[model samples]
Target: MTEFVRVLLPLAPAVPLVLALLGLLLRRPTSLLPLAALPGLAAAFVSPTGEIISLPWLLLGISFRLDPLGAVFLGFASLLWTLAGLYAYAYLGGKQGEGRFCLFWNLTLAGTSGTFVAADAATFYLSFALLSLAAYGLVVHERSKAAWRAGRVYIVLAIFGETCLLLGLLLGANAADSLLIDDVRAALAVSPWRDAAILALLMGFGLKAGLVPLHVWLPLAHSAAPVPASAVLSGVIVKAGLIGLIRFLPIDALPSWADTLLWLGLATAWSGILLGLPQRQPKAVLAYSTMSQMGLMVAVLGAGFGAGVAGTTMATALYATHHGLAKGALFLAVGVVAAGAGRAAIPLLVVVAVLGAAIAGMPFTGGALAKLAIKDSLGSGPVGLLASLSAIGTMLLMLRTLVLLVAQRPPAAVAHASAGLIGPFVATAAAALVVPWLLFPVLTGRPLAYAFASPVIWDALWPIFVAVVIASPAFLRSIAVGDIAGPVEAVLRRVGGSWTAWHPPRPAIDGPRLLTRLVKPAQSLETWLAGSAASGSALLLVAVLLGFAALI
Candidate 1:
């Protein structure tokens, strides 16, 4: 029974993907959204605990394990995917090429869920590749010039990330002589190549997670994708890299590298805030916010790595679960507003505010719990201070998001949103609020009541206060940061103008001349060598040279 559940758990996400393909082929793509989420939902509830199954003959003996960490991420990711799926149903109704979107959507879902459950290097890589590539379809669904450009940037960065991960996985497999995560981790704990492996893994997964410098594609991709795609892309897909980092990096074995990661994570956290401030589009702003939040997650993982691997897995998983749900809710709320659901606007605003607070580590939200769970690991020094500042940065970003949300209201007020849309939005918001509280005690081994204490609550509130205070002047002064890409656009246009001027088009050629021109002197020489006499002469010359050399 346990083994069956383990195998079925991995297969569960694929069911919806298959159904989506069938629906597309049958020209009944409307049903594909709900169909895509069912397997993920079932797996979340029915998969047995601590089950491990191996298939050595397939994909280098890939393994699947339903451990606590995997279960937490899988459960939340599945749940969010379901909500996004339902939201997509109504949001994309009667839209053209939605069938294609649904197909890619389901494929990405399957890959993300599979990544969480996969126990071996090969399985993880397979899932990672699938998720990354399928997401490209989502990014470029609009097929506009901007979307195309965004897609190009996304693919290039994604390929770079994959190469890094593949090399790391190879090193890991070679060191351990096993592809399973547990064995590789165990091997890394004592191996001399630990630093190299961790660095490779960080670069690969960090790119996906939108760590600094590698984060260039995230804002562009998220802003260009359709609403539902953006929701899942920002909320869920990026977390795959976080899961990879948690699973593969030998956190317990390398404190020095871990500290380095923590510092880098700090830089990432601030970089997003610094870069995000200048954006006008709400989606682009949110994209940068996602980058910032991902940086915080990286910081948490770095802290865990520094502290040793004992509790890091569970801590990172809990943090990721909270982030996945809250971020999904926030993105969905953005979609609701964008759709002109004005009557539902204020309430959604409130919900978004709460979600934003959670991202900023407001007391009693999932974010606070996540922070507390990993607080000890981060320790009290510059690292902790930097971690605390991330909360402030989040607060600033969220405040900016709120101001933009209110300012960008449609010229005409809209009626309430459909149940299909509002239902998932509300469900995710409630989960973001309540689920973390329930999970916190189990994850932190502390009383839930500790969260409400004055000191803890104050710690959470003051950072938000500071952020608000800092942002108020900027808001009042009408100091707009503007778009970062604007300057680049001017430069590109200038270069394009110069190139067009420097190169003039040639006149059309007649057929014979065109064919002759196509075959250059080098090509004619190659063709002549390929003829029978030339081939025989060339071979004879080579044979004679060999004979002369032998005789000498």
Candidate 2:
């Protein structure tokens, strides 16, 4: 039985991939597609921890494993994918392009499941690339101009991140002299190229993790993709990067790098909140919140790295699990609340708000337990204070989400939620609340007693109280980067028009005339600098000429 279960671990992902291939041959079977996630769900519960499955016959000796850390991530990621599958079934029903959507759906599912279990560098990168690329199909499923734009940006970054991962892997493999993840990190600790390798890994994974500037694709992709796809994207896809950082970086080996990570995480944490404050779209708000939540998770990992503690891995996973499930639920609620009416609306709104608050570390919630789990890792100092402020900002973000959700309620008579749609969300929301409590003991080795302690509860509540005290209706209004960009674009357009009006295309002159005479040299210089090779030569020539003139 033990051996059989171990074999089934890799099969979890293999099942969906097989289904995806089968989908290519047969008619689109909508009803059967969601069942593809069942194997992953089973693997999450039944796969023995610390078991490794190596396949020398496949993908150049690929390996998969289920250590406690991977299992923590695997559990929630599988759960979210499963729920998103069911939700997609209902959400995409009778819609156009169902077949194509189903294909990408299973392909993405396979990649997501495979990524969690992958134990080797090559296998992890393959799975990561697979999901990152496959999701481009999902992002562009609607084929709207916006969807295409999002897809273009997503694919560009996905390729860029993959390139980074490739370089990092090459450097890491060379340093470690092994392909296994553990061996790579072990070798990385002592390698001469450690800093370069780490920087490469950070940029590669950080792009996927939605670290700032790289994060612009997130809101665009989330808002453009379908609801169920949005849930998985926000909830599970970003966790790939989290898992990457967790697996690749040697927390015990680099304290200075860890401090660098701490500041980066802090900046990402606050940047998301500040940027999200002005966004009006519910999905966009949730997207930025995903970035904010990821920032917190990165901070946990940084703190762990700084302290050179191995146990902080579990803390990071716990925090990620909580955020993953809650954010997934919140994204799904956007669809549910929009589709629901009257009395059902209020209850749905309440449920959404509760889950959102969980992201903000509401008392008696998984978020609270997650906060408590990592308290020691963060330390009660300036970083801790900033973490607290991040929590309050999360409260504001969630509050803004709830207000937006309430505003989406239909004006018609009360209509109950579809069993198809609401069922997955409610189950996810329930898991978001219950699973953390169950896993807290196992993940952290702390007794359940510590969770319910008054001090812990109070520590969680104060952030919520502060957020509530400062929050207002006006503050909840939708704001976005476009607000600033919109005006800037207008100004640029006016300037360009003025420049064009002034210049007026030089009147087709063969030789340089009055206005064109002075501009001729500048245009020649501009054209010369525009050439890649010429630009370098031009600078050197200018330097030589200046030096010669100086000598004279």
Candidate 3:
């Protein structure tokens, strides 16, 4: 029974995916969206233990492990995907190409769920690749120029991240002489390539986590994607990278690298907030906020790394799980409001504010428990100071998001919002409040009361208060970066015009300009021969002959 449940746990996410694919073939995509998360829901509740399903031919195997860490991620990721799936139904009702969106959505769900259970390098890579690539369709679903451009940027960054990860995994496997995660960690602990492996892993995963300097694509992609897609992108897809960091890196073995990770994480946390403050779009603001939140997660991991491996993993996962649910709910709220669910706006806004504060470690929320869990790891240092300030940054960003939501609300929308939209939004908001408390005691090994102590509550509140103070003048002034579209469009036009002007037109072979333009047959033939298929075959044949002759 346990074995069966284990197998089903990983396959659960795939069921929705398979149904979605079937829907595509049958030209009945909408039916698949709601059913997409059924299997995952079952898996989360079953709490299956480790079960491996090998596929030697594919050079990979699936393993479902329901350890506390994986379970925390899988539980919420599945829940969020389920809710987002339902939301997508209403959000995208009557839209053309629902089939394409559903297809990518399911594939992403499969990849995300698989990542939590994958025990080997091959399985992890395959799942990571699926999540990364399938998300491209979502990013470009609108088929608009901006969507296409955002998709392009997303693909480039994603592929780059993949390359780094592939190389890192190869190094990991080579050092370990086995692809199993436990073995890899054991091997990495004693391996000579530890530093190189760490660097590769950090770059690969950091890109996806939206770490600074490599995070340029995040805001653009999130803002451009459809609402449901944005929710999953911010909520689930980014967590895959966090999982990768937690699972792959040898946090136990390297204190120096851990410290370095602490600094890098701090940099990412600040960078996201600083850039986010200048943005105007609600989705884009959320994207930067995701980046900022992930940075804090990375910091937690880094500090945990410094303290000890086991604590770091547990604490990081706890923090990530909290962020995932809260962020997912917030993104879903963004979509609901945008779709004209404004009647419930006040309560939803309050929900958003609390989640935002919770992110900043507000008392009684999961975020505060997460902060308490990691406080020991980070210690009372400058890293702690930055961590505190990050919460403040989150508060400011959320406040900005709330203001934008209020300003952008349509007058008519204030009175009517569909129950279909409101239901999931409310459920998610409620989960955002409740689930964290349920998970906190188990993950943190601390009493719930620890989260509400005077010092802890004060610590969380003051940063938000400071941020509120800083943002008041800016908010009152209606300060904004103004429309960036005009300058960007003009630059694109100029670049296109220049390319046209610089290119010489082809002349007819028999025309007056043909003689000057045409190449000599001997030269042209030589050039063509060097690049031609026949020439390439000949070169290959010659190389083979030379090798044979040498062997003789």
Candidate with the greatest lDDT versus the true structure: 2
lDDT of 2 by residue, 1-552 (tens): 877788778887898888887776655455657688777778788888876788899857878998878778878888888888888878886678887888898888889888889888999989999999999999999898568657855776677778778888889989887888999988888888888888889877887888764666687788889998999899989999988998998756788888877888888888789878778788888888898888878887898779766578898889889888989999899888877744666677888888988888898888888888888888889998899889999999899888777777776665656889989889989999888998889889899888788888888999999999999867744454322222222333344557888887755456546667656654553443333222243234433322332233
| Span of 10 residues, lowest total lDDT, candidate 2 | 481-490
Colliding pairs, model 3? none
Clashing pairs in 1: 56-61, 278-482
After superposing all C-alphas onto the true structure, candidate 1 shows an RMSD in angstroms of 11.9
TM, every model:
0.85, 0.86, 0.85
RMSD of 2: 9.2
> Between the candidate structures 1 and 3, which one is better when assessed by lDDT?
1
Task: Give the poorly placed runs of model 1, Cα more than 4 Å off.
Answer: 1-4, 56-61, 189-193, 413-416, 473-552
Q: List model 1 lDDT by residue over 1-552, tens digit each.
A: 765656577575567667756867756575667656666566766887666766777655666777777778877887888888888888887788878888888889878878988878888899899999999999999998568767866786687778778888888888899888888877876777877877788888998998866676788899898887898898889999888887888765677777777877778788788777766777777888888878877887778677664576677677777877888888888778877765677888988898888888888688888777777767778888888877887888788788888887775456556787888899988988788888887877889888888988988889988987888524332212222232332333344457758985465567667756754642543443232222234234433322332233
Question: lDDT per prediction?
Answer: 0.76, 0.80, 0.75
Q: How close is candidate 2 to the true structure, as a TM-score?
A: 0.86
Better by lDDT, candidate 3 or 2? 2
lDDT of model number 3: 0.75
